[model samples]
Target: MSFKTILAVVTDQAHMSDTLAQAVTMADALDAHLSVVCIGVDRTQTGYYYAGMNAAVLQETMNHAREQAAELATAAKKQMEMSGLRWGVSEAVCQLADMSRYVAAHARFADLAILPRPYGDDRGIELEAATEGALFEGQSPVIVLPEGGAELKMPQKIAVGWNESAEALRAVRSALPFLIAAQSVHIVVIDPPKHGPNRSDPGGQLSQYLARHGVKVEIDVLSKTMPRVSDVMRRHVSDMNADLVVMGAYGHSRFREAILGGATRNMLETSEVPVFMAH
Candidate 1:
């Protein structure tokens, strides 16, 4: 399936400008509608009526949030128009419920959601909450762009973390559009020495599979002695100058392992490139 609409979740964060630009560019390329959503807290809802904050203070805070939302919406709309994309900007403020859940619910119909990496103070926690809800709860493919990652070209080289699991296969299928556009595609698999499959080599099997699709593909295997699977993947991503990384989200329960699995967790923490992930 191809993406027909791109949803960008924007907030008062460090990479707002860059993220907005990237979202516009992608929307233009895909000829998709760009929806820039800004989420905030609203003090006017009924649930907060009991809190005894002075009337003036509550009014001031609510007014300030509304003003900020308007400013952000205007800036985002200007950028989208400047990019020559057919776009629509939206804003949502919820006082009675969590903003993250609201964003996730809206994200359900979107083809993809682009989010900024969490950074600094309470911002990190907020970003994480939103990202988790959108990724796990929304059931939509999400792209988490690194800070200051506005300049995104069609990726020349794409790397897929392959383990032949169900999640890996799903990730690969979800990324086929990008793969078809990529100049080079590499499948990196880390094999366990002691207890894993023992064949002459399964890497060639995957390469042959891709070759059938008229894609120039290669496979690389790292030794079991490598420091960590994620570390090895990051090293290769740097060496290969890969612009995009595709991987499966290997997590069972939200609270049990919010950022579960080895490769998913490590790349989320250290990779300098954009990651395309799906559960």
Candidate 2:
């Protein structure tokens, strides 16, 4: 499906430029509306329970955060205009207690959300939570950019992390727009240990399926040495210099990710390129 509105979640962290650039590029390509969200802390509410800081100090802190958020939105708007893409800028005052919830609420109005992967020493937990919120709560497809990667083009080479699971199949179907646009596509079947009786070769099946849809396709079986499916898929992207990776989001509980931490989260944290994820 074509995306008409794209939401990008930005914060005071590293890799903001890359994330902004990617968002602008996608908006330009799709001629879509872009929304840049800056998540910040609200210290006013925190002062009610804390004894160390007073109302005046908390207000000062919140004021500073608001200034920073405005600056970030301004810079992102400038970048989008520089790229010749028309976009609208938006800012929200959020409390840490419900920041993810706020993001999810805003996402309800957009077609997609672009987020940065979890990395570095300090912001790892926050990134993880935000990404989880985007995937589980937003209930929309998310595009995650790597930590320090270059901007992605039209994704000439695309990799789909395929399994027999319903989620993986849904992701593949949701990514059809990109697949149709990509010059080359690879369907990677991540087989489970101790193959079962009904475990048909997904790679071959998917290749044949896409060929009918006019996508130039290839299949590759990962070696046994590469155990976890997510890790192997990421390694393939790096080795092949793929521009985009597509996979499914897996979550067992509201607060927990399932086995392998889900392909979406794994590639987001470790990939060297862009990843398109859907639940």
Candidate 3:
């Protein structure tokens, strides 16, 4: 029901500071225990399979990977020490293929996972792997923070994007703690279906459910003027000044989203505010 244990995934040293600061802030706000995991992806796996690979070159490459991981672990320890929150630090040096598995193992024990935005300036294959691992493999709710997102205050106004899918329902349930604590919670349903229960009431059911959980709930049913669902959702977030967005991630198969471009992908690529997501 509450975030008592939080996991922060760090793949590189450059953005580690901002990532940890965001995690620490969330832990401090929720009085949660913070678990930091630094993942060092060994890029030498490709060369290791080469028939003519040199023994010394392989050893040097492996050593470099471990050293990078060690540096991140050291940095995490120092930051966590100064954070003054109940925390722990761990690190791993694994092949790129295994990065997500390592992250998922750590994520399984936490109530929620936080990761740097996997896109933009510092984007990497490792960051994308970490995000997928936490969301799908670990089966946990995740918060993806934008650049300098460490500066965010505890979310007050929240927006929930609803489409009546099972994924949407799960996301709403996972975000219950935040919704209960938020000053305002808007259940935004875009271009709702014309038939069935939604015909008479679109966000009505969800609003009542949240109200029962002590959420100050409202319904914002709007026509879809934009080409994509995410675009409509984004404008609504801006118009309402919502600090956070809670929504289901990858309602379709990952491949489908990649090829067809679903709302989850768009929101991840473009949202400036923090996105709280669950599969």
lDDT of 1: 0.73
TM-score of 3: 0.95
Q: Per-prediction TM-score, please?
A: 0.84, 0.86, 0.95
lDDT of 3 by residue, 1-279 (tens): 899999998878888998899889899999999999887778766544677877887888789888988999999999999988999998888888887788888888889999988867558878888999999889989999876643655789999999998888999999999999899999999999998866799988888898998999999999999999999999999999999999999989988987888899899888989999998
Question: RMSD per prediction, one decimal?
Answer: 3.4, 2.9, 1.6
Q: Is candidate 1 or candidate 3 better by lDDT?
A: 3
Off by over 4 Å in 3: 45-48
Point out the higher-scoring one by lDDT: 2 or 3. Answer: 3
Local accuracy of candidate 1 as per-residue lDDT tens digits, 1-279: 678888888766455688887787777777788788875556464556546777897788777777767777777777777777777888765542466687788678888887776533435455766676676678777777875553665677998888767777777777777777789999887773445573556556667767777667888776655677888888888889899898887544545445444667667767788888888
Clashing pairs in 3: none
Question: Which 10-residue span in candidate 1 carries the lowest summed lDDT?
Answer: 251-260
Model 1 quality (TM-score): 0.84
Error of 1 at 181 (Å): 1.4
Q: How many residue pairs clash in each candidate?
A: 0, 0, 0
lDDT score for candidate 2 against the true structure: 0.73
Top model number, TM-score: 3
